[model samples]
Target: MSEHAKLPQDLDPDRPSGARIYDFFLGGSSNFTSDRMLARRVLAVAPDMRRNAVANRACLHRVVRMCLAAGVRQFLDIGCGIPTIGTPHEVAQRLDPSARVVYVDNEPVAVTHGELVLAGNPNAAIVRADLRDTEEVLTADATRRLLDFDRPVAVLMFAVLHHISDRDDPAGTLRSYLAALAPGSFLALTHLTADHAPEAMRAVTELLLDSQHPGTPRSKAYLESLLDGLELLEPGVVPIAEWRPEHGDADLATAAPLGYAAVARKP
Candidate 1:
């Protein structure tokens, strides 16, 4: 397991965090031993996890570019994990310096490292909050400062919703955020599913049940329901790897069974 030179005081190194485990799957060094341990267990059951992470991240990048191409300059990336290469802000700001982004994550390590990575970039900021709490996230100082609800904004929820349990009412939480967005705004999301490799994914989910972030991989129909009342984009909801893939992304098809992704406008 990789070790960071310094970690947040409030971070519990013994507890495995979903965000940190994702970072580990991305081959990033922002994870603790506990996180890596859990990730390894998951990989043993679902060897495609690393590839799935890559595909999910690629989907996020494409979503950002698509939103930018559609003239949406502001972004709210809720449940944004540890900041890494090809983040929404990096992609958006590179294309349009005026583009603004707000990243929200409940993990202390993610928030701390995000703050450090975003430090001098006036166009971007990170907020520490639970995504289920729409009000807190929407009203946070950083979110309000960087994003204007009156204008078109891209709300990103890549590899996030599955982490929210049914008890928290993930769909209701999503609706609250969607209701806040303007008509021209966009919602791009990716969620894990057990459609293709049910047994493997179910085992993975069981292992994560005791972690800091338990997950509930849903069905494609259920994920599609989350986009109700919005204008679904072309190609409709499909495997993450098939969502407007770019050159050299053909290999992503191998991981397509892992998750579902889609982008829609509020209309």
Candidate 2:
């Protein structure tokens, strides 16, 4: 494992973080040298990392749009990284002025950035919390202030699950969150998987595991099991690029590695 230096609340100039590495991949400047170094090393193994990030981000946008169409005005985005341009709150509020959103991230930098981005928006707030602790996440002051559990809520976990290693019991964590939602609520997720590109994807996973954010990628079967009790929407557990893509893909034969997106409803 890499020995990383600690970073302050405002900036972690020495240590590498998953959120910052992701930001670097997305061409954002919020990351430090350590993060960029790891990002580059992982990219050497998986050249499609950039494409994977973009496809998952697009899926996030599409899911949010679908939520708006479905008349969901309350959103709880867990494991949301440093807020960049066109975040969930920005998109949801544009769709409905009354829309409320709460962003949660374990990284202090992520929470700080989210707070700044959401400043002056009474309907939105940010909290620093771990996704593994579903109880605290759902019942936190920020969640209570911005979301009403009595009403339908759209919970988003886009491209964040892969970071939750197998030992963490990702399924159990998801179940706790799902159990807390009201009927008619929704669960939208985009996770990294190696089922499609085993060799290359595994190399990336191993690299990340040795880096600051330790994690493991799951197979399609494991991912499907995570949605056991919920009713999956159309195109269940497919490539993110294939999930209601604004522009349909002419070729759906080859599967995209390092990404899978799906949205389910709790009945």
Candidate 3:
């Protein structure tokens, strides 16, 4: 069957989505032709796009493990694209069967695929909503059913904030979400940046300007400012691959310049 046939009827297979594009970058089969086409364009200028995606994903795995080790059992993965291998729920549930996860995303394809992937799993559910809509997401039936704001929850936002424009107030959106969580909750974030390769990143940014999800790569200084209230964890806001790599994974070090990552506590 064709990729379009596999997608939900309500989705436009021709329209490129950032979630699908990132899924393609991670070598997943959930993306459409349009998503691959846009990804190829990005790869042409930013040859390290796929590597950076993998690095960012690895960072997420480390964060989940750290959170679980810290005694956190609930996870709110905002803008969690199509569920792929080693996803928060899968990683957490593997370590602790009772761990609850609520995946949130506004993309129809992502939500549809997430539902299918999470089927029969009572401990996990997918919520379709924009991350910027703090109240809506926090109050969503699935979110409330699976996560308890009175207890600590890990808010995962990997490779999603760049799509949030400045006018939308990314910092404020984060604050609002963090405000809903109880103290001691964690925020694990990984964002694209132009600090390492300005010209190449600028070219990629221009290519995506007209796409469905235009990206805005910020500098380390600016991304750091977003975590003002939260107490940033050790090795603050370093490259995605550099954040507590398991066994000192030397290969990921090269991709470090592509993005910044950090896990902070809502103290």
The number of the candidate with the highest lDDT is 1
State TM-scores per candidate.
0.97, 0.92, 0.96
lDDT of 3: 0.89
Q: Write the per-residue lDDT of candidate 3 for residues 64-100, one digit (tens) a residue.
A: 9999999999999999998899889999999999999
Candidate number that wins on TM-score, 1 or 2: 1
Write the candidate numbers in order of decreasing TM-score. 1, 3, 2
Candidate 1 at residue 83, lDDT? 88
The candidate scoring highest on TM-score is: 1
lDDT of 3 at 46: 90
Question: lDDT (CA) for every model shown?
Answer: 0.90, 0.82, 0.89
Q: Which stretches of candidate 3 lie over 4 Å from their true place?
A: 4-6
TM-score of the candidate numbered 2?
Answer: 0.92
Candidate 2 lDDT score at position 46: 83
Per-residue CA lDDT of model 1 for 1-267, tens digit only, reads: 246567788888899999999999998988888898899999999998888899999989989999999999999999999988999899999999999999999999899988999999998999999898899999999988888899999999999999999999998998999999999999999989999999998899999986899999999899778888899997888888889899966687774388889998999
